[model samples]
Target chain A: MVHQYKLNGYHIVLDTCSGSVHAVDEVAYDIIGLYEEKTEEEITAQILEKYRGREDVTREEIRLCLADVAKLKQQGKLFTPDTYAPLANEFKERSGNVVKALCLHVAHTCNLNCAYCFASQGKYHGERALMSFETGKRALDFLIEHSGSRTNLEVDFFGGEPLMNWEVVKQLVLYARSVEKEHRKNFRFTLTTNGMLIDDDVIDFANREMSNVVLSLDGRKEVHDRLRVDYAGNGSFDRIVPKFQKLVAARGGKNYYMRGTFTHQNPDFTRDIDEMLRLGFTELSMEPVVCAPADPAALTQEDLTVVLKEYELLAQKMLDAKREGKEFTFYHYMIDLTKGPCIYKRISGCGSGTEYMAVTPWGDLYPCHQFVGEEKYKLGDIWNGISNHGAQEEFCACNAYTRKECEDCWAKLYCSGGCAANAYHAAGSVSGIYAAGCELFKKRMECAVMLQVADALPRQE
Target chain B: MKRIQTLETKNLCESAKKGGCGECQTSCQSACKTSCGIANQKCEKKDER
Candidate 1:
């Protein structure tokens, strides 16, 4: 299917199934829009009348444009048929459910209490605890054992505050590095922290060892301070921002994300993004607050309306910045149009549950961090591997085409059927779809497409 | 910024049918896909100044 839209002074057309993108002038754009339903003669007449005053839009030019659109259709470039439904289930089969990555919850406790934290302040509704070194070691071994023939194994040090158990995180990284060579494996380690405990040692070790570091900050001081607070009910923004800035500065050219969550309290998230930009943060992501509908921080329908406009504004701002040699990258807008995810990844989604799983501090396995502490989703422990094969099969069966709502949606392929954890939380099933997240995703996809169109296509005016 | 129209696809998965899926490690990011400010993989490509 061909989806057409006008954005940022350009007419962009995208073929959803085939992943073909085209930019055309006004007459050509109009003709391509009605090429399917209307007769050629009718389209030509409509275009002629629409552009009647423009001498540049003659019937001869319309004919050529019509021929070009038809040529694209014949070549399976535009209006491409959806032939991926049957292959969707085949993704899990191709890899044989070999494990590839693990998100190790080193600590189930947080230094700061953020109101909208979906992790429930890192406890996940459980008691506070730090993963023992023994548990972490076993988790790594579990990943290696289950990962058949895959050399590039990934482990992310995540938690309430990974740095809270600093010694264990350090030891785990050291252990992984030491064993990787003997096993003929390459372990890429990443760490995500709130920047509360960042210092010389943290910075030095992260730079030297971790493949990537993710720092959490919610834009400006007021917005950040509103929810992210300390035990004393004091805002932790002041405490964390300086630390994060110092860490990023020391990080130099290394990869990092200055991540933030925009809640209903701040649906004008573009301002927060601007705040991040002003703080010299270029690599950023300001996600909408995803929580139970009853939660005060949860994004409401009205908030969603504002948030959509914010995405559009953010895209336009990025384009302007790119032109001015001040471009900042947004996580959602980082669309590698040329060589995106492989077909297997595109159809199968995030590879969670089967190819990837989350390990709690105690070594209990879940589909992902979002499913941690939930008995229903517990697949097994690191010692015995995945005992609950049913959960694995369920995640394996879940993909872009699993839900009927996603069948006709143009953004289906991009999002990979949305997050399974989000689906389960919202719709009470892993296979179900999160309607709000879907709407936000569609808007982001549109903006992402617009950015690529502006950057990759020739503009008419 | 001179934007040019382009088709950005190598369709590598197309070759997977011929048994080419697992061998390619291609720039796939983090294992966990959930975006709970925790597991989401950071994809930051900083442009060299």
Candidate 2:
């Protein structure tokens, strides 16, 4: 049986075979009653009226309009006039040339042995290393030269462990301050760390220099211990939480984030939300673990349930936090609020080829954290820089998935194609890492958002 | 002929004789054989209504 699914303005056919379905879109649908049951003559009259006094409305113009309308109608897809027109205007308004975010991999060496390490793929090995002072200068120079005068640039420090290379980080932060001073450019600094390194020195530096810091904590001790362990198989949770405590004490509910990755292994992980709040972290970001056969942290089906359950719980926890007079915010909510209408145009999440770019120690520029090691999807080498202009062009052209197939997908906007590393290693592609994660993250966020939004509303007695 | 879920699930341990249907001999088969065992489970739960 053939079932037609209308997405955006296009029609796709899903062919069902033996209870399985495959999707295809080829035929154009007719558009007479697309907006209702208007006759062809009535539609023609309306088009003529709208295009009145325009000498360019020739027979060809009318024919094209009819064809497009017909195609839309047959596909059972129709966009209201008000909705479609502004979206078109928005497409024209977006700046096609700006890089909104920049990911700087300041170090190649990691402090822990994550079982699902993309760095260990094929023959890629880990080594203790840091981005040199010279490379740091070059990166800053490149950003200064390339960024437009009016653009806001965010510089994010990623790792092995970003704090492992604190020396270079200090230099970079100082440089970014100078850049902001000289160019009067809007500059924001953020760091993603493994939490064990969030001591006083790091907290002081982040508070003084960087705008925000993200710490990786996979729920509780056991789940984190199993996946993110040191060489001797010791768990990092107990060691890392204290450092987070210090940061909380230092910042004291100002604005610091605790980021957690709950792979399928952490069952009923939602319980950690209260614990995280109790620990005094005001902001939180949670990501579900994507499993590959070779990933060290593969969990049972029950684990995945726990991860989702925890996300749902976090939503309720945020509501409870508000009720208790606790002031806190999640980044996802900020995005939905601040990002204006063309949110669909923003890359679903983050990556090099989209809003951000990551540089490895070898001076190779891949999209972002996810595709750290796979060489095939390497966008550019740091020494020479991104060479393929067209690949970047195609990367920009992809719209955030929002058709019937992708709408209601939780990660729709957040997944940002999944990790570039995951795409490159698992599927040997870099095109949709953000999309894969977008679907998952969207599912996570929607439940959280609904719970919070409901909690925020005035109750009807 | 008997149904074999996905080839990857039944490839390792499930033995089928030339003229006979066979039972899966390993735990992995139970998970990998169908439209992905995890996916199947989700679908089953979804369909309960």
Candidate 3:
């Protein structure tokens, strides 16, 4: 299918099935739009009517445009057959049972009460608690038993603050390592923390054992402090920055990412990113805050233009950095076009409900980390296998191909129908699209395209 | 128009679903490697290219 849009005065046509993007002239754009609906004679007549008075616009010119469309059709760039349906069926039949990754909510409560905390201050809107050692052990055992032939498995020690339940985490890692030889499975451990309790011992242990660490420090001191504050309303920036720096230094800035969140307050978000760079972070991802629209700091419709412009500015800065050989990777900017998501992913999304699952502190299983606290999404406990196969099947069924809006979207493949949690939060359905998030994704895609093209161009001396 | 006019028009997913697992294996592989220390070597090699 062909999806066309006008961006920055250029006519962009996207072939959805084949993932081919083209910048065509007005005549060619019109021809592409009319190709399926109208016969060649009708299309030619319509083109003539569009450029009625212009002597330069002739029947021959319209035919040439038609020829171009036909060429695209012949090259399988237009009207390409659906390859995802068969693959989706095959995947469901052969690959749905193997659970490869699990996000272990080691701590149910967090110390900081960030303004837009999705987990409602890390308690997941539930009571404050930490996962016991026995519960964690059972969850690991569940993963190992159900993992099928998958030799590699993932476990993330997540929480209000995983460091709050540091002992259990340490013991679990040691336990997982001990059982790996017997089960013929290798466990890779990751720790996500707020960095408040990251002392020398915590840092030393993480550096030695954790395969990756995600440090949450929104941005600059002021921005971070405004939203992410302690229980006493004190800013975490002062306490966390030093710890984060030490952690990064110890890890040699590898296998870790400094994750930040941008809100309506930070319209010129590039400045926050610049601050991160100045603070000596190389791997960075500054995501837009996702929360209820009622929140004062949440990004609204009014903020879309400024937010998109900020992304453009950041993209330009990234290109400039690349030129200077001081390049740092931005998570959103790193879209590998050639080896991007497959047709299956573009349809069914990241396989959250099937391939990946999240386990709460009490061993309650859910589709993913985002759905951990909500009781309705609970698949089962670790003691029992997945009891709610229906819910998992429902999530697995949600793909771009099944969503009416996404069927015609050019950005569908890149977006993969968007995050399921964001969709549920926005419109109460997994197939729905959040408007602000969708807009941000499109802007990012446009910026990514520009960056990719910029990189391919021959550098002038 | 002037900014993007010089962009070499290209398909975003040229080799997508050609021979490998039809997913952006980077995310899953990285999630495993960073969080678990278990690397999907097959995906790691593909991502490096």
Candidate 4:
């Protein structure tokens, strides 16, 4: 199927099946739009009527444009067939359950009390707990044991605030390092924290041992403080921002993301991103908050419109900034058109249950951190491995094709059927599509494509 | 009116899909390597033109 849209002064057409992107002029765009549905004679007549007075848009030129569309289709770049549908299930199955990543919830508790905390203030609506070093060690061992021929395995030390259990976090890294070479594995660890406990030691060790670090900051002080407040109801923005700056500064150009969440309160989330840029934080991601619609922080219908425009503006701003020699990386806007993820990766979506799982502080496994509290999703523990084979199979099958809503969606390949965790929360099933999220995601994809086009086709002065 | 210009004919269907698991590349939808270290594009493969 083909999808067409006009954004940022450019007409874009996406061949959904073949992943080809074309930027055509208004005339060619109109002709291509009609090529699949109308006969050549009819399309020419329509274009002639539409561009009646324009000499450039003659019937012959219209037919020429139509021929170009036909050429693209013949080359398998336009109106391409869904050749990957039959291969989706078997393609993913070939990966064969070789787990390569594990999210170790080192602390099921947080030092701060962010009102919009999806994990219910890091307790995940459960008792506050910290994972023991032994449990973490076993979790690393579980990864190595199941990683098959994969040499590089990843472990993310996540939590309400992982620094809440600082000693164990350090110990687990030491343990993983101690055994990585022995097991013929290379462990890349990441720490996701609120920046509440960053210090010289934390920064030094993070730069040394951790391959990457994710610092949680919701942009500007007022915006971040609105929901991410401390238990005493005071803003923790001041306390954390400086520390985050220091840690990232010491990171020595290593991998780090100044991750934030955008909600109804901040639909003009680009302002928050600008604040991050002002603070010298380059790699960034401001994800939309996925919560109940009834919640005050939820993005309302009006906010969706604002958010969509913001995505377009964000892309343009990034391109302009690059020209001015101040380009920053926005996570979703980073698209590698040349060597993007293979079709199987795009089809199967995020491997939440099949190849990746989240471990709780008590060593119990869930498909991801979002499903941590739900007993039904519990996929056994590190010691016993995945006992809930049913959930595993369901997630393994839950790819872009599994969701009916994704069938005709143009952005399905980029998002890989959307996040299963967000889908479950929004629609009450992993296979269900989060409609609002889809809208925002499509806009982001459009903006990403436009940015790529702008970079390639610099405008003439 | 630039005509119908193909900005990208990378053809992810035929080329990209054939490679087994590229969990670390920016192309993967997971946002990062293996377990989603969260938007980790530090290792983004430069375009091999």
**What's the lDDT for residue A323 in model 4?**
89
lDDT, residue A387, model 2: 82
Report how far off residue A192 is in candidate 4 (Å): 1.1
Give one digit per residue, the lDDT tens place, for model 1 in A144-189: 8888888878888898889999999999989988999989888888
TM-score of 3: 0.83
Q: Which candidate is the best by TM-score?
A: 4
lDDT of 2 by residue, A11-84 (tens): 33211111111111221222222325576566666656766776755445556656654453343333311122
Global lDDT of each candidate: 0.78, 0.50, 0.73, 0.80
After TM-score superposition, the amount by which residue A396's alpha carbon in candidate 1 deviates from its true location, in angstroms, is 1.1
Residue-wise lDDT of candidate 1 within B1-49, one digit each (tens)?
A: 0112445653433533543244322122332234421112221222100
User: Estimated TM-score per prediction?
Assistant: 0.93, 0.65, 0.83, 0.94
Per residue, candidate 4 scores C-alpha lDDT tens digits across A106-199 of 9988989987888889999899999998998888888888888777788888888998898998998988888988888888888888888899
Ranking by TM-score: 4, 1, 3, 2
| Model 4 residue B23 distance off true place after TM-score fit, in angstroms | 4.4
lDDT-superior candidate, 1 or 3:
1
Model 3 residue A451 lDDT? 61
| DockQ for the candidates, in order | 0.19, 0.01, 0.15, 0.32
